[model samples]
Target: MAEGGQIDTDILSDEAFDVLCSMCKNQGKNTEGEQYCVDCKDYFCVSCVKVHSKVPLCAGHKVLDKSQIKSRTSKGLPRAPTERCDRHSHKHIDMYCQKHDTVGCSTCMAVDHRLCKDTFYIPEFIQNNTYQVVATREIQTKLKALDTILAEKADRFKQDKQRLLKRKAEILADIRKFRQEINDHLDKLEKSSINEIEDKVKSLEDKIKDSLKQLQANKSRITSINDKLTSTNTNQSEVFVYVKMAEDAATVAYKYIDDSELQCTTEDIEYQPDITIPTQLEEKKTLGTLAKKHTKTSVSLFQI
Candidate 1:
């Protein structure tokens, strides 16, 4: 036995460093033998290397040292034999036995797979297909998952849009209600002020009418007394009494006349409402800071 089990000297010679040729065994010179692959440990001559390279399945194997092969075999690792099987040790399973689902040497093939017609070489089977079929189902599953994720993201975006729209409508309705309240308050204040101004104007007109009537009566009496004094046969005492009465009426009318009332003063008043709507709200536009100040005055009449 070599290291682990019995050695097959027909495949490897213990004296020579080169592996045996699979075509011509011990009869050929050792220099005529082929180089062996380090990874797969398969022997191939110059011509065999060329033919193996042309074949699709065996093109990727690397060739290395024969001494390295011995070290690997001593360590209980499989070595590429000249005519033995790649899987089984000490048993050269050459021909594939389909009935038993295994490869066999001449003895095994004759014994186990004699009538089995489904057997084939490994190289021929691998060359018939260009790509591996094991990864197809896994790739399809990942693609389906990615599609589902994208669809869910699209639905979420649509739902978010609808929610935003509802929120926007609610905000707009609130703004409108606030604006209406501001307008109603302002209108009430303006109406109250107008009514107060009209009442003051009516009282001032009545006082003005009473003063004008008194002034007209004083003027008429003074004119009549002067005409009597200018007559040819005039009474001095009667004329004097008429003049005294006219003078008293004139003083009374002057006191009753409201001189300060007719002189109205316009005061520039500024009012900032407690509940003020923005200028933008009044204009019914988007809010911005653009305003210009113009002076506005209110006139009020008062008696001295």
Candidate 2:
């Protein structure tokens, strides 16, 4: 098991080790893994190793003691059976054919790949194609750079959305404040015009009240003269004098009331509420974009 309790496929399990040793089980008394036959790609018990060494064909095969066998895999790849070919049963894959981009055994090289332009032993091929290994590492580097670029762009986009939302709130607040200022200014103008109209009307009302009071006093004087003349208790000359004085006062007061300019109208000083958003805030553009491209390369793993 791995660190997280997940099964690690690269390590050989007990059951798999038992299965590999089964090939030598018939010849062995003690069936416990003690050695690995590299050529046969199998595990062998102690008795099985003695028998395998005696055979002429198996004698040439490479053997490893259990303690000498490496357990961990390389580059996360399971320990590949490099001693045998996948296509040919028990045949060793020692030749690499550059023309076909594949590794094959002796029979495969003699038949289908005899006319191939370039061929070499697997060890020589790997030694000669170090450039291909470098190229693969370069590709990994490029991909890692792309990962960083994508992560940064994603973070920038997230920040852009957040910033735009915050800026919208700020602009809304400014607009509301401007609207309130406009309303307040209009309120001030309306109140001033209304006060002026009220003052004009009040002044005209006071003047009218004063004129009525004077007319009432003149009527009282005229009535007093009539009562004296009818009762024969006053002189006719004094009654004529009272009538003349009342007539002069009446004509002047009536003319002044009719001629005085005491009217007020809101048509000249009416307040209006009209506001338009300024030019800078009216722009319609939202945001921008970025573009990236990938190019093809002419390189092959088999080419050195």
Instruction: Give the Å error, residue 67, model 2.
Output: 28
Q: Quote the positional error of residue 33 for candidate 2 in Å.
A: 12
lDDT digits (tens) for residues 119-151 of candidate 1:
533222222224243233333333334334434
Q: Which ranges of candidate 2 are over 4 A from the true structure?
A: 1-131, 182-304
Which number leads on lDDT? 2
Q: Using TM-score as the measure, which candidate wins? A: 2
TM accuracy, model 1: 0.22
Task: Give lDDT tens digits, candidate 2, residues 1-304.
Answer: 1111111233432232333364456555446667777566677777778888899888656565665454423421122224455467665555556566555665677677777756554433332344233333343343334334434433433443343334334433433454455433333433443354345334434543554454445444444433433343132222222232334433443343344323211111112222432332233121111112111221110100
Off by over 4 Å in 1: 1-130, 184-304
